[model samples]
Target: MTNYVGSCLCGAVTFEIEAEFESFYLCHCKHCQKDTGSAFAANLFSQTGKLIWCSGEDNISSFTLAGSQHQKSFCKDCGTALPNNHSSGILVVPAGCLDTDVAVIPTAHIFMSSKASWESNVVNIRKLEGLPE
Candidate 1:
C-alpha cells in the first residue's frame, strides 16, 4: 500500500495515510456543507488506511455534531481540515489537504438531494486565476 502525506493550512499539523484509498466521494449532506462551508466535502475513504500523525499532533482538534454522525477534524491554528477516522472505522481524508497527487478521482456525489441549488452550475462559471473585478 502506498502512503501519502498531508498537512494543515497553517502547517501546524502534518500527517500520513498508510494505504491506498478505496474510493473518493463528494458529500453534499447538510452537515457536510456546513462543516466545510462549501457546496460539499471531497473525502477519500479507506478502511485499511492507518492515520499517522507525523508532527504537531497537539495542534489537531476534532468535533462531532451532537446527536449526529457528522464529524470533522481540523488544525486548531488555521482551521484547515485534517483527516480523521469515521465512526464506521473508515479513514476519511479531506482531499484538498494532500500535497501529494491522488490518482483516483471522486466516484460520485452522495446526498445530492441535499445539495445547495447554486452548487451544480459551478462548471459554467467563468474561470479566473483570482477574484474578478
Candidate 2:
C-alpha cells in the first residue's frame, strides 16, 4: 500500500491516507454538479480507516445534504472541498486535492445520463448511464 497526502485549497486542512491506488470516476449526478459547481466531479475511492487527518481537523466543515447519506467536507477558510466518508465506509477523495501523482485513470463515467451534452466523450472509457456495471 502507498501513502498519499492531501490538503485543502487554503492549506488549512491536511490529511493522509494509506491505500492502494485505484481507478477513479467522473460523476455527473445533479448533486455532484451542484456541489462542485462543475459539469462533473472527479473522485478517488479507497477503503475506510486508512485515512488520517494530519492537520487542521478543526478547520474542516461538514454538511449533510437533505435526502443524502453522504456528508460533504470542505475547508472552512477557502471552501475547498475535501474527502468524506461514504455510507459504505469508503473515503471519497476529490481527485484535485491529492498531493501525490495519481496512477489510476478514470474507469467509467457515472450518471452519464445527467452529463452535459456539450461535454466531449471520454475516449476508451466505459460510459454508463448510472453506476458502472
Candidate 3:
C-alpha cells in the first residue's frame, strides 16, 4: 500500500492514508455541487480504517446537512474540504486534495440527472443518472 499525505490549503490540518488506489467517481449531486461550489466533486473511495489524521485534528470542522446522512469535513482555517467517512463504512476522499498522484482515473460519473447545465461533457466515462450502486 502506498502512503498518501494531504493538508488543508492553510496547512492547519494534515492527514495521511495508507491504501492502494481505489475507484474514482465524479458526483454531480446538488448537495455536492453546492458544498464544493463546483460543477462536480471528484471522489476517491477507499476502504475505511486506512485513514489517519497526522495532525491538526482540532482544526477540522464538520458539517452534517439536514436530512442527509453524510458528514462533510473541512479545515476550519482554510476551508479545505477533507475526506469523510460515511455510515456505509467507506472513506470518501476528495481527489483534488490528494498530494500524491492517484493511479486510477475517474471511471464513472454519478448524479448525471442533476449535472450543471453549463458543465462540459467528459468523454469515456460511464454516466449514471444518480449514484451508482
Candidate 4:
C-alpha cells in the first residue's frame, strides 16, 4: 500500500491520502476550467475514506455551482485546490496539489465538447521546466 501527501500553495493546509486512486480524469467542463482558472482540471478519484487531513483542516473551503453537482474545495489562504467528498461516496483530489508521483496516468480527456478553443494544438507551444527566457 502506498500513501500520497499534498499541501496547499501556502502550506497552510496539508493532507494525506491512501494510494487507492483508481482513475484520473482531465475534465474540460466549464465549471472545472473556471474553478482551476485554466484549461482543465486533473482529478483523481477514490473512496472518501482514503483522505486524511494532516493539518490546517480549518483553512479549507468548498464551493458548489448552483443547480449542479460540480463542486470544488480549496485552501482559503492560498487558494490551492483540496480534495472534495461527494455524497456518492467518492473523493475527488486535485492532481496539482499532490506532492507525490501519480503512478497512473490520465486515461482520457473528458467533456471535450466544453473545452476552450485555445486549449487545443498544445504540442506546438514551447515547453519549459520553469519560466521562459
Could you tell me which 10 consecutive residues in candidate 4 have the lowest summed lDDT? 43-52
> Which clashing pairs does model 3 show?
none
Candidate 4 structure, TM-score to reference: 0.94
Candidate 3: segments with Cα more than 4 A from true spot: 121-133
TM-score of model number 1: 0.94
lDDT of 1 by residue, 1-133 (tens): 9889999888889988888888999999999999889999999989899999999999988999999988899998999999999898989999999988999988998999999999878999889899888
Q: Global CA lDDT of candidate 3, please?
A: 0.84
Per-residue accuracy of model 2 over 1-118 as CA lDDT, tens digit each: 8888999888989999888646588899888888898888899887743889999999988888888765678998998888888777788888898898888899788998998765
Clashing pairs in 4: none
Worst 10 contiguous positions by lDDT, candidate 3? 118-127
**lDDT (10s digit) by residue, model 4, range 65-93:** 88999988999999999998875779898
lDDT of 4: 0.88
lDDT of each prediction vs. the true structure? Answer: 0.91, 0.83, 0.84, 0.88
Q: Write down the TM-score of every candidate.
A: 0.94, 0.83, 0.84, 0.94
* Candidate 3 per-residue lDDT over residues 1-133, each given as its tens digit: 7788888898878899887656788989999899899998888887743888988999988898888865688998888989877677888888877887878888899999999987865555678999989
- Candidate 2's C-alpha runs over 4 A off are 120-133
For candidate 4, give the lDDT of residue 61: 89
